[model samples]
Target: MDTPGPRRLAGRVWIVPGDPDPENIRGSVAVVADDSGSVVVDAGQSPAHAREIQSAIRAAGLPPARWLVYTHHHWDHVWGACAWPDVEIVGHVSGQEILRREAARPWSHRYLRDEVRANPRLGPSFRARALAMQGWDDFTILPPGRTFTDELTLPTGVRLRHVGGAHAPDSTVALVPDSKVALLGDCFYPPPAHLRAPDDGPDLAMVRDLLSDDYEWYVDSHGEPTTLEQARRLVST
Candidate 1:
């Protein structure tokens, strides 16, 4: 399938939809434009993908992305940080530890393949998907430069709250209060079976708590944008 461009969501917000292809799982990237500039959520899976998002953001006539925020430290959600050296990166404090650890690991194809072979249960799917993408020569992982604890409100009024769950202990939710849009990342999904993750699924209670807010739309990293009613139904199930 041809890669799609960023689609507008609410006032000053747009999403570069994710590709669910088994071999190349690209997570969605959200952009919130404010007077200062664009606040992007998730740098994407690769530098190439991040470049596409940057191009799309420019094409949409939104300001250049001044801030790149990570919902978690997962590779699919942040490996593209290398592409935005000029943008300030933001993430949960806990995610910094994970990214630091990831930075130490050798990301070469052979090393990754060997690691996957030796510890096949951990993240074979992630390895397979990453390997399928083009150019691993410059595939560098970077930790966030600026970290936050419970919550942070950007200068633009985009609020970020740490709402960790089963998917990731450092998972966060980005809320554009004025726009009534929330970017939920992959926090609502259960861990992949291959990882043998101990937790059953995301904290639905915390997720449900979000429904009490005034968000009109909820977007998961790999799914279509959903209305409040649709989001409620999803959380219930």
Candidate 2:
């Protein structure tokens, strides 16, 4: 049988793990379902795996994904988006531009040197992990069919709000008011290191503001479900 998938967060919200090895950088995709149908938050690495995500949704009693919201322009996030054909793809306006730029550049040298080469203090195995996480050579850029800045609420009642920037340029977080859950993309990771300087933004404060008392639970692109208290500690430290 296939490896057991990631666990569910709340009703209709499932967190699926992507290549979880050190190099691959623990990436997780979230799935949400409602009367309007199902929507996937950030597609994972492999197209085949993304189809599996669609399968998981169907098994969970939701329709095939009606929409895909890309958190940012990262290859791991958008690589599998094509698996959901005909859906209205959405992303930040700047994210679209980044995708275009990546597509135009040669694949072998996609990421900045600093990103690919980490400090040894991070670990002796850091280089291997960095290479594995930089799985962008085969990525194909798919421009978002719909792009927005500031904030946009979907007809399904889920709100897409730009949380300044954290993990990547033009990164945005998705908030589900009814579920009291927020898809934090890559903004906030759990303790030890609550916030890291984002590729584009300063720190995790933007993510913290979005998670302020309004949201009870948070689903990050990585790590387990988090809470407002955890986010608060993260921001404070």
Candidate 3:
């Protein structure tokens, strides 16, 4: 399938939808741009994925990304950091340890294969899918250079808050108030298949709090854009 291009969500916000492919589980990449430049949320899964987003940015006439803000420290969300060497990287303070560990590890398919074999949390079938991916020949994982504890606002008007949830404790939600949109990057979802137990879901209070923002649309990293009312109903149930 030809990868889809970024789609405008609101005012100056656009989202490059995440691919649900098991072999390539990439999270959505969001761009919020103004005269200052663009702030990208989530670096994507690989160099190829980051390049795809960059291409979209150019085609849309948006300024080059000035900052790459992470929603969490998951590999699929932050591994493409190498692609934005010049862009400032920002993430939750808690992610520092995790990213440090990941950056120290070897990234070859062979190492990853062994990792999956020994790490049950990675899932039983992940080894096969990891090996099946295009190529691990060219990739790098860089830890965020800047970290925030609670909330942060970029000079360009993008706001980020660490809203830890069951999906991932470091998960964050990005708000583009001017655009009236919330980029809830996996923060409202249940734990991933490998980590999920029968009763797992996002923390109701945390998810509900996101609704308090004056956003007209909510964009979950793995799902379609939803209306505020629709998003409210989702967390309420």
For every model shown, what is its TM-score relative to the native structure?
Answer: 0.92, 0.76, 0.90
lDDT of every model, 2 decimals: 0.83, 0.68, 0.80
Worst lDDT window (10 residues) for model 3? 124-133
- Model 3 root mean square deviation, Cα atoms: 2.2
Q: Highest TM-score: which candidate?
A: 1
- Candidate 3 residues lying further than 4 Å off, grouped into runs, are 124-138
Question: Model 3's lDDT to the true fold?
Answer: 0.80
Work out candidate 1's RMSD over C-alphas: 2.0
Candidate 2 has what TM-score? 0.76
Candidate 2 ranges beyond 4 A from true positions? 1-3, 105-139, 188-202
Question: What ordering of candidates by lDDT runs from best to worst?
Answer: 1, 3, 2
Model 3 lDDT per residue over 128-166, tens place: 336334666566577778889999998998999998877
Which candidate has the highest lDDT of all? 1
The alpha-carbon lDDT assigned to residue 135 of candidate 1 equals 71
Clashes of each: 0, 2, 0
TM-score of 1: 0.92
> In order, what is each prediction's RMSD in angstroms?
2.0, 5.3, 2.2
lDDT agreement of model 1 with the native: 0.83
